[model samples]
Target chain A: GESVGLHLPTLSVQEGDNSIINCAYSNSASDYFIWYKQESGKGPQFIIDIRSNMDKRQGQRVTVLLNKTVKHLSLQIAATQPGDSAVYFCAEGRDSNYQLIWGAGTKLIIKP
Target chain B: EADIYQTPRYLVIGTGKKITLECSQTMGHDKMYWYQQDPGMELHLIHYSYGVNSTEKGDLSSESTVSRIRTEHFPLTLESARPSHTSQYLCASSDFMGSRETQYFGPGTRLLVL
Candidate 1:
């Protein structure tokens, strides 16, 4: 069963600091990846996405890095804020029918 | 903003009750998906539809069923809700925008089987 998984269950960060969330995927056939931010009692929101051909992609204050060699993916958020606290999840997708494989989320906690 | 909507944001029902979670999207997307997620857990795909009159089960084995009679609406029905079915249901829709298909999600419905 090919799946996506996160390295940490929770991450505590202070305001104005940079936060990094790591993910590992088992499927080599996956070509696209996405990061989602899910707040309490809400659905997951799109954050950033990266394709396998590229190594890094940046958007606003968020950046997504993909390493196909190690099958690793990471999301970095700059200037963490209280509003940035949420559960972050990484999803992997293949070319067949565009079905996405989800990873267990990592809780991001911001300390004021 | 995405035009996806889900009804009954929160639900608390007894065991063996029948329940249907309604999901509708005005984005005119050809793809729709249903996912079940527990608190602080990963989302499991339960069902999905490629288009109107097309429905398929996802990676997860779920007791619920879904119908795609209309392109903009996809509803999931549970014949007998049990304690194990207590979870959050999320609906999403995506257009056939070539290779990069970004899925827009709706506010989820939280279910509690008492």
Candidate 2:
């Protein structure tokens, strides 16, 4: 479930710099992984989650890195702010009864 | 103020009519969700409920339909509207009990089935 091509790809950080967003997932049993923050009209707010035996996880300023061999997943934003711009999603799951499975969103622009 | 509410934030119905999209939560969550995005796409789960009247059906095949009597309400109905059913319709709630439960979203409900 990964094929979205219109490329809204853009990430220009600067406010205080430190923003990285990258994702590549295709389920390898997808234990659990989440990071979402969509702002334009809102409705996507959980911003940090990691499972799959844990590869990395942090919160508050955000940070979630998990690489199950290469299924890759990353989201690090510490300090950047303009309210943190918008669109940022990367989710996968196979836990808590399953529900998440999203990624094709990465638009965090805040270069002031 | 734990909240999650969605309503007619914006609508423009005209095709076949009959639309209902309202979701509420005062945080007494018992798991509830419904998602469908279309602008930048990716986020498709059509329905879910793990409490009250319990309902389930998600994975994009949705003509719309959901209900959960009272656990803070979970409504989504389309019965008719079309035009591919416009877009944006999100409502989430979580805390399916114990162990790290996260998912609290609302502030979405933008339909335009014209």
**TM-score for all predictions?**
0.97, 0.33
Q: Which numbered prediction scores highest in DockQ against the true structure?
A: 1
The sequence of per-residue lDDT tens digits that candidate 1 reaches over residues A1-112 is: 8889999999999999999999999998887999999999889998888888999999999999999999999999999999999999999886666588999999999998
lDDT of 2 by residue, B60-91 (tens): 88788998999999999988998988989988
Instruction: Please report how far candidate 2 places residue B17 from its true position, in Å.
Output: 12
Top-scoring candidate (lDDT): 1
Pairs clashing within candidate 2:
none
* Residue A61 shift from truth in candidate 2, angstroms: 15
Task: State in Å the error of residue A67, model 2.
Answer: 14
Query: How much is A91 displaced in model 2, in angstroms?
Result: 7.7
Looking at model 1, residue A90 earns an lDDT score of 97
